[model samples]
Target: MPRFPRLTAAATAALALGLLAAAPATSDEPLVTEARVSAHFDLAAGQTPENIALDGDGSADLTFALARQVAHVTADGATSIRATLPAVAHPATPIVTSAAVTGIARAHDGTLYVNYATGTSATGVWRLPPDGGAPEQIAALPADGLPNGLALDEARGMLYVADSVRGTVWRVPRAGGTAAVWATGAALAPLPAPPAYGFGANGIKLRRDAVWVSNTDRGTLLRIPVLQDGSAGPAETRANGLDGVDDFAFPGHGRSVLAALNSGSRVVLVRADGTVTTVLTEADGLSHPTAVAVRGRTVYVPSAALSTQRDPNLVLARLRHFISRG
Candidate 1:
């Protein structure tokens, strides 16, 4: 996660007025309508949602980063805590400054997988069985590294984790065992720290036989092919100039995606050809949106409010359609 300074009262007021909108969308940009906050979270209680996983019935599983809890939100906006990660005695996490639960993925069997970065030995991937037992650490990741993104390949019984600090992707067995570095390269490494704290691979998703990752420091989206033998192929840039991009989701069965620009407080639709379209912004109730998930035409975006410290929430929007430019 990238750290951002809090907005001044004047700046916040301007943003609320839509005077400081993120790069305005062109006529050719994708149209997102009926954008509204579906669920409001408590900023003081640390209910800021960092990432989301959608269930079959329109419910959502969310990782409340600062709260260190995994919660459920129903289609009608009802929210409840599903599980809470164990608290650390002396918290000392890298970059973000606190122990947190980040990315999440739900399995076909109703199992839930999530990443926790505690800067302690307990930092790793955890599993919450559908039977409602206590969540347990399944794989151990580097205590110094920030595991921010997680994706499950259910058919292959594998889990892919994006380590923001280590600049690597680790592969862990679905049954809980030793983890292995699946891929690493310059494309995944964080930018040299004159800025002091920068994240490398922040978000990840498995789709269309490839693993897509977002590099926050590099401000780019990358795609690494899954070779026939299940090895990672060369990494290629899909889109760039997405400064502050944290997490993203494919809205349709297409190459285009809606990405969360955390620092920019906006969500942009990146087309197949890499053309970027500003769709949702701070005016639409996004308080530094951290991740996106879509089910049919319904889009779910969770805001962490790391900078805003205001209304951290889950916003729902309708993906109307992309405007075709002739």
Candidate 2:
């Protein structure tokens, strides 16, 4: 079966321009434009923070669970050794030893919650107190056989886990007990895997009344309107054509959803109206960033050292507020 090209007449005419124009048309949608990606913020040496966790203590903590260890440092400092996820992969690792903090959530009351969607079985979800010391297991929710992404509903105290393997979105209480099947739609379906996310869900986030799921396998973003009881509303494609969207950041008081775009050395910003723009070029030396979070105006992104990872590359970039085009 071949894809019936959805090319427009303008695109068809552009194809007449030569093979170069048609070259880009083959991909259907181009998420980034040359204008949006105008700057690059190189990675900081020591305080290279991955996975930004905004704490109520007015301090920002970064999680690095790579090479079988999950540790935390400050996004505001030049690298400070604090604590590590004690589950230990081979030695003292993040949770399941090699699995890192894919997604993290914090309550208004200042409770810290973390998710372990990869690595070994001992890995799951954990919680930290307001002051931050040791993280304890909540209960053992039923995550997709191989979980990876997560989101938190602070007001209602619900945690949503994106089980890419099972194609299911699971929910559990803040205290942690039994994982309940919250919503099962495209996420829980028998989608293909790897290279193309038939069901490869990664990053998840909650805004006002909805939850956003990132389909890295297919370069699409799903926004499922959620209710107070965890029931889902209409699910729609918020943004697409991303180059492996590992994580996203909503630079507050603005209209930008800055994302950690893998496969490329930049952070892309997608507006609410579905128009995409590139905000940074060669963002913090990002290497397929896997996790991201935002606080007020600042943005934090964590890159995965896939190949030659020397030292640890954790990046914290301040997302400049976008000026309205109108």
Runs of candidate 2 exceeding 4 Å displacement: 1-50, 56-58, 67-72, 88-98, 118-121, 131-133, 142-144, 187-199, 253-255, 307-311, 322-326
lDDT of 1 at 231: 91
Q: Which 10 successive residues of model 2 have the least lDDT summed? A: 15-24
Question: What's the C-alpha lDDT at position 70 in model 2?
Answer: 34
- The CA lDDT at 91 in model 2 is 27
Clashes of 2: 14
Best by lDDT: 1
What TM-score, computed on C-alpha atoms, does each candidate reach?
A: 0.90, 0.72
The C-alpha stretches of model 1 lying farther than 4 A from their native spots are 2-30, 322-326
With candidate 2 superimposed using the best TM-score fit, by how many Å does residue 177's alpha carbon deviate from the native?
1.2
Query: lDDT for every model?
Result: 0.85, 0.54
The TM-score that candidate 2 achieves is 0.72
lDDT for each residue of candidate 1 in 1-326, tens digit (9 for 90 to 100): 43444357654332211112233356765579899898999877778788899999999999988889999999989999999999988766776657889889999889999999989988999999988889999999999999999999988889999998899999999999999999999899888665734689989999879999999889899999999888999998999999888999987666778999987799998987899978899999999899999887799999988777789899999866532321
RMSD of each: 6.3, 12.0
